[model samples]
Target chain A: MHTTDTETFEEQFAIEQRLVDSVVASFDSTTDPRLKELMQSLTRHLHAFIREVRLSEDEWSNAIAFLTAVGNITDDRRQEFILLSDVLGVSMQTIAVSNPAYEDATESTVFGPFFVEDAPEVTLGGDIAGGATGQPCWIEGTVTDTAGNPVPEARIEVWQNDEDGFYDVQYSDGRVSGRAHLFSDAHGRYRFWGMTPVPYPIPSDGPVGKMLAATNRSPMRVAHLHFMVTADGLRTLVTHIFVAGDPQLERGDSVFGVKDSLIKDFVEQPPGTPTPDGRHIGDRNWARCEFDIVLAPEQI
Target chain B: MHTTDTETFEEQFAIEQRLVDSVVASFDSTTDPRLKELMQSLTRHLHAFIREVRLSEDEWSNAIAFLTAVGNITDDRRQEFILLSDVLGVSMQTIAVSNPAYEDATESTVFGPFFVEDAPEVTLGGDIAGGATGQPCWIEGTVTDTAGNPVPEARIEVWQNDEDGFYDVQYSDGRVSGRAHLFSDAHGRYRFWGMTPVPYPIPSDGPVGKMLAATNRSPMRVAHLHFMVTADGLRTLVTHIFVAGDPQLERGDSVFGVKDSLIKDFVEQPPGTPTPDGRHIGDRNWARCEFDIVLAPEQI
Candidate 1:
């Protein structure tokens, strides 16, 4: 007794197309144009991805479960979704798009999860490796404008993992080390003493780690130091300088933070070498690196 | 002392492209070809989407938070992610892709979150509106092959919300109503006395509902009855029959489950009219609908 009419494939596709239109139209009343645009673009790309993959019911369910796991494993100390994005190269791509191309400016990478606000300020050539176990290293850098003019009194924030490949916060001993804030002097020069960088595996105990394992990808990042530089009339610069000869650089950093221009040689020095401040270095051998930063002029 | 080299936009894009390639290549060792393909395609599309959107850090954080909220709100009684997919048209697209068009076959839609296992069975011409309140109605259907041959004794599972827009499970009163199982008779015929379907809002109290509100979209679905038909030699069919001329049909369903061919007239019958099974006329008027299902041949 029911009607015998059936839809052809073309008709079904039309129905789906209409659905997409309806979803896109639903956002027309959004108060914020940017949010509307984002929602519309997200809907289109999500639908297209599903269709392109011919996603099956089981596959969809698996995706849902995987995402749920990713959410569940995320917490104060870990950001599995960001890790997922990083592994997919989305984080780096976003940085590239957001920063665009600025001549002579330090290239930005992912502002990783370990930055601590208001790290203790250090004086020129001061040691920031308080109670941290690592090879002693001296870091000096100069701040300059895109036009090669020295930018005096620019604030430089630096943080990095110790030789053991762990940030100061990662330790449970309630100690602060391996990170500090400093300012460029009148000559646009700044220096600090810290630990030699060591390549480290990203936290690999969460859903993101499981995904990496399943996909046969390593979770190692090239040894590096994070820097954030700011001056009154210059655009802020957030970046990392990778050790020039680190093996992980050639192998591809897990977070895709390595840039050829940002790599620097961490020169080795024997014990008892004269320090930059006219003091004799300790008996322990040390390494040194100089990274000069150039900032783009801020748009009015 | 640091190198003054800077990468151009083209070079940065090339680095990202290589990173994407590396991520895709990581899947080559996957034992399952389908999973490998899915992961690779997912990586490529995800990277493309990020680049196209030029997603900002704040936007990325918002996305992560939104997904986490969706997962946190999902449980045994609700599936927020599926609702997210439904609202975005991904669910309908997936259904369309999964179920290809077949001659004379019923069109499929999404299998929503309310399906329960082992619903009570009803015999031919049996009443399935057990101890529930709604306008009386009769539903009759036939199961046949694409060639119009009757497929005797096919199983048809039915479920729907009551006039109050609540499924039996949605009620805390432990009442059983609005859903049941029925089998076709020898001639591939089945009939059940039920209740009139009514438009209802999808559970809008969670993250999905918030998303809809944020996007200015309604969460209403047109009046419809869900059906799942299965026979020995035919592919199983899961779909819904919407009430013809339901206002929501043209307005667009919240879940995008509506199809032109699946909409049918629920003809109203006045009191004192003889029933199809020769039953006595009742004082209260009732509605009647016939939905015949034609299933495609199952692949071996």
Candidate 2:
């Protein structure tokens, strides 16, 4: 479309649309069909968004600068882009789209940036609160197939922040805490000792925090424990269990990760209750929760 | 909207929609209403795009990496983000949206990154080809208001790359060439001697270039001269005059800066025609072009 010296608004809009089409068509020679399709859709949607909002040059420049800052602050320990996606709910949306609902299977959530490979493994009923400070809590869960049959020897990786809301990586001293891997017993039952989960704010000292502040939004995730459960013939599940009564849950998770099934009651046990391993009861208070995970069949 | 253990596709979609709504609502407390509105619209559109495309985790990671590379390559001397926007047609779209159609006024284009402030000032008919090697060309233009009345004493800033297709900033020797500022004569006419405009590829040693190559798109912008004309009571015009009949014009410009009205014929004159100032027309051939710029009245 050729724009003349005197163009009506409609004509100019059409010219812009044609330009979008031209950009989309430029991807015709892309060798990867998926990339071609993605690029075309992205161009169309991005242009439409710009036109819809009448985005100004100053706003565009601001966005570029904001994105650049996000990239600049990124490093081995921090994934600001992923955090941006999480706060925007795009990560959860992608998870929902990629992992469709299966009958009685575990719902997946975002695999946050803190997962570490080769977490120290523990036996069933072992404590994973190494060098961590918090109220002791017993986490017992079962791993089973959709048919309710036991899936023995499944690997369960659990990670969370300490009571002070600091992850192991966040510590300047390079201390490891509040994260470990364990295998389910022959009865498909796994239990470990951990800290009582607490609501915590995501890192907010960077550009993303500035964005959240500008938008009057909080950068807090609900109290929760992250879990990645993997079995021999089932789909791997990365999910989280939220503390049922955490105020942040009602306020809505910043990452959009709170699902109804994933919320569990962290029952406070009185000091007189007997321990699961026949240990003597102590005056210290503790919490207990039981979560049963169901895995979907792996595609052939 | 909470998701249960059993969710139909529609139910899951509703959940995702609710997540989007929550995010949008989170911006309700934004102090700046315009920013709040923009954030809401942007969040909705961006979430919708992700849902429509069903973007996968791997694809999302790829996008993050690509944007990081683009940001990493950007610096004072180079702006890869702007290049990315230009290639995607966003910069042009923003210009079109920002500058609406004005009656008989010069249409604006992108102010490319090569523009340097405080360029050497020259007389109405001075040569701006400083320490540059190229076939000589004469550019003459008149500045007029919308009613076709000449506006005298207008400031005109002209800049372009040398015949080698490299802007002054792109050189390593720290030499300045092919750019200058001049004022129009009493008759609102201005003329200058410089290299013949030639099509040139944008810097392709960055991530934006990789994107272009991957998408099978060219990095060549159409041959053109950059101009910024400003007068006392008239709106400033940032635009380009494309050399007509250039092959790249038909192929589409990399920056989407070309417009039908901005195209002008650069007529070739074999070594015989007298120069504009009656300078000796030696054995060297030259070209000539006339561009008339019209400025709009500045709004109060």
Maximum-lDDT candidate: 2
- Cα lDDT, all candidates: 0.81, 0.85
Cα deviation of A126 in candidate 1 (Å)?
5.8
Candidate 1 stretches with Cα past 4 Å from truth are A1-19, A29-31, A115-133, A149-159, A162-189, A230-233, A271-285, B1-31, B116-136, B149-157, B162-188, B192-194, B230-233, B269-286
| Candidate 1 share of real interface contacts | 0.57
Candidate 1, residues A1-300, lDDT tens digits: the string is: 332345354575676677678778878888888889888887777777777788987788787778878767666556677778887777777787778657667888887777788889999899888777788888998899988988999998888888788888777776788888989999998899887888998878888888778777788999998998989989888899888888888777887788788999899888888777765666878899999998888761
Model 2 TM-score (2 dp): 0.88
In angstroms, the error of model 1 at B132 is: 6.5
Q: Find the 10 residues in a row with the least total lDDT in model 1 chain A.
A: A1-10
Error of 2 at A185 (Å): 4.4
TM-score for every candidate vs. truth? 0.83, 0.88
**Clash statistics: count for each candidate:** 0, 0
Model 2: CA > 4 A from native: A1-7, A116-132, A171-176, A185-187, A269-284, B1-7, B113-133, B149-155, B171-187, B230-233, B269-274, B277-283
lDDT of 1 by residue, B126-240 (tens): 8777876777788887888888888888988888888788888778777778788988988888898887788999989888898889878889998988888888978888899
Fnat of each prediction, in sequence? 0.57, 0.55
State the displacement of the C-alpha of residue B283, model 1, in Å, after optimal TM-score superposition. 7.0
